[model samples]
Target: MSNIIGIGGSIHDFASCLLIDKQMNAIEDERITRVRHAINSSNPCQPSLQYCLNWAGLQLEDIDTIIANDDLLQVIDPHVYPDIVLVNHHLTHAYSTFFTSPFEEAAILVLDGAGSKLSGTNGDIRETTTYAYGNKNDVTVINRVFGDLKGKNYVTKSETLMSNSIGEFYRAIAENLELGWLVGPGKVMGLSSYGASFGDDRFISEMMSCIKLLPEGQFKININGEKGLIDKFFQIRQNYHKKEDPFRIDAAIAHAGQVVLEKVLFHTLDYLSTKIQTKNLCLAGGVALNSLVNGKIPFLTKFKNVHVFFAPGDSGTAIGASIWGYLNNSNQTDDLIRFHSGPFLGRPYSSDEIVTALNSIGLTYTQPVDLYHQVAHLLSRGRTVAWYQGSSEFGPRALGNRSILADPRNSLMRDHINSNIKHREWFRPLAPAVLDSTTAVYFDAHCLSHWMQFVWHVRKKFHKILPSITHVDGGARVQSVSKDENPSFYTLLENFQQITGIPILLNTSFNIKGEPIVETPYEAIHAFLESQIDVLVLGEFLVVKKFDLTFKSPI
Candidate 1:
């Protein structure tokens, strides 16, 4: 009966979402533009708003309310506006995750680069108790109530403002690396896995030097600036006589430092749960994407349940913002809606578009009903194919809907994909998209990651067989695919398995080096033609790129 639109901007990712009667219809962003977190300068929400409206079979005028995330409204275009409702970034993150999680009550920990303030000297460490309504008829729905973890009894703080944040710490580190603030944090995460822990003395000294642990809380020095935080970190590395490998001892120390930060947060939350007598927690924000840190929560916290939003990063804020708007304006608390799996809520391609692209590229392909079998045939022959079908994905990973597929059975395929297709860091590992049913056979069930989120030890029996996708540490970041979530991808894996007896495929983003993941058929085709990829599957049509095997190495 109602249509709500949510928009988030002026942050790292400009995103928008449409919720029809509390059901997510579509979600997308400006990153498809390849600007790397482009801010909406003019009518920032215009593109996404329009797209969402179209997808929902509605118009802007048909929207009942608009939700704006964080303090985006202050910077966004005022003229092109909807009846607005505003929500803090962290709370929005919590909402997005808790609402979607299978648990009715779970411990939520939302960590991000920066969001609207909650409370404390450093806003990064605000603890709160939130109760969500499951049924539309239920009336008691408080998004969050701030809580304190001083001694034994957790006291609710009505008026306390602070700004010390975990998000800033990571951002500062990314800036210090000269890897582009918003961009290189993941690289830092990967580099950290290679280093040794900073242990007690060194870790404590570094913490005291960089952050001041005050009576109320901690505060990090304002070290993030134009010169970048990574450069400053390198200077500190020089003082310690560190090596050139970004993955060296110093890098490991830094990674260990992050672990310490998470520990502090864990202790604070533990103390809080005892005082509040709540067994559930909800998490959101960019840092929630840190699967390693997330994996530690079940072991460290007393909370019985932990839930993180799928799109914990800024992109999800758009959905949060809109939901907040509807709740506040309507003054009605409704049942939390579940988000559909796969971020393929963006624009879809028409058969006409697919055919035009294939014809223009001057490539030969067949439109077989068994699309999966044909594509699998290409992979069985050691060919790499860019697969772009249905709607583009919403997050950083190419979750099958928009991905480059290669044979995981070939040990050298990782290098081929990285060098010729992705053109990313050689040290960086590729992910394997494995059939859900076969996941336990290849990886530890503890490593049964669904979103390419966590690293797991690959079974020794399959390590050499899938060396290209497996890491040197005997680990692989696997994305478990189910036919229900993504039928096309699942069927493709099944077909590939039938041909090669391997359920996993070398899956990487469908883009070249330094490019945003392919958003449209044109971008997908262009990348396929320019790169060494053997074929391009755009919807029903499959276009093969005929090229001589003779090629010089670019890496």
Candidate 2:
């Protein structure tokens, strides 16, 4: 058996994964550091690499191969390691999709910022990369669009980019709005729903002038596109300021950008569909994390099926690279090995760690006779609890395993969680972990969304009761929890449902604002003790502060 480790990410969402044949163990660097997208790059740190090795129950000498998603990322040690495989940035993103997806043969599309530095003049920025066909055995690349973006000294003074990159356009929009480039499109998506749609508002459509469409579906952004959009926003700021609502202009701009993103992508998909008859698609890259845009693809385009792997952002490339390394070498790529146990691949804490942390605070706790049932009982009483169970998830999302959950019916919980708990924007919405079978009853979910990567509309009737889980636009980032995938987490939900009529919970990542999702039992306890977070559920033991309601607002 060979031990293959894959590392990915440069600027943000860094992760490492160890794949022993079909079995996989992975962890994101942010989890260990407790920073939302740690900045240290140019070399892989010991904690993350060692975590991968420890997950595989291996030593330094036990590793047989090291695979980095980007060769020029300067993260992996080239000379210190003998057997090293460096896959291209977009290629690894492609592998993450085809291999993780159920389809044996599928079309792959990748969209992101310039993943790697540009090489040619015509292909200035690599915005869209596509793998025409893929099977369990191999993926064939018929189109490569990522190597087009010119960064650094790669382009001439006159040439800014190979093509008008939707990613760069979106980046400009996000950066201009004050959300850092590293922050994904989530905040924009949240804000977009609060504004008027193009058809409903002439002002929103007027903002689309910057994006220019050319012959044969080719497009370019005028030099004035980014500046014009921002300038127009500021010019009209006085009008919005005259109004009571502070977010009026911000929401309008977000709505305009969202409209541009969705429409342009829909047109691109239609154009591509005309060229290729294949209906199955596997999508990857940072842009794939845009659930607002992703949710519309199946409906807007001719494609019948679209598969986007969990951790589609750069963090997932580590798993993709390792999978590529093993399968490419063995030539058994066609028969893709499914990464079972889901993406909760971080290191598990032993019972010893849990007990030690609990004892440190002199906190009294009791292991319930039935952990799931008792946890459900606590939730039934409207107790918001930090639940830490299995290995932490390896992405921006905190799927049940590392989540803070409360009663979905409690509408006030949203504001409470936002202002007192999460310390994020008051406008940001929460998500729901619904029973897989009952997902359609509450959401207009067309397919099974195991990961919260798709936006599903909350049913009209449930909107009033499930206000915390439902966004202002009626969309809920839905995660349909399957019993087979995570039995323990599913059981907790089942217990909660048994106690309450609703199966959904107001779920968010278990951490204070600006912190990464809690990784270790120690971190979970640390967060629990520090924040207004009501209770700490680490493994079987649940600890609560004596004066649970006595904390000051984190906001």
TM-score of each: 0.82, 0.90
Give the alpha carbon lDDT tens digit for every residue of 68-108 in model 1.
77547556765567557666666676666665666544545
Model 2 poorest 10 in a row by lDDT? 150-159
Q: What does the lDDT read for residue 131 in candidate 1?
A: 31
Top model number, TM-score: 2
The per-candidate count of clashes, in order, stands at 23, 14
What is the TM-score of candidate 1?
0.82
lDDT of 2 by residue, 111-144 (tens): 7665654455343444453435676567776654
Question: What C-alpha lDDT values do all the predictions have?
Answer: 0.65, 0.74
Predicted model with the maximum lDDT: 2
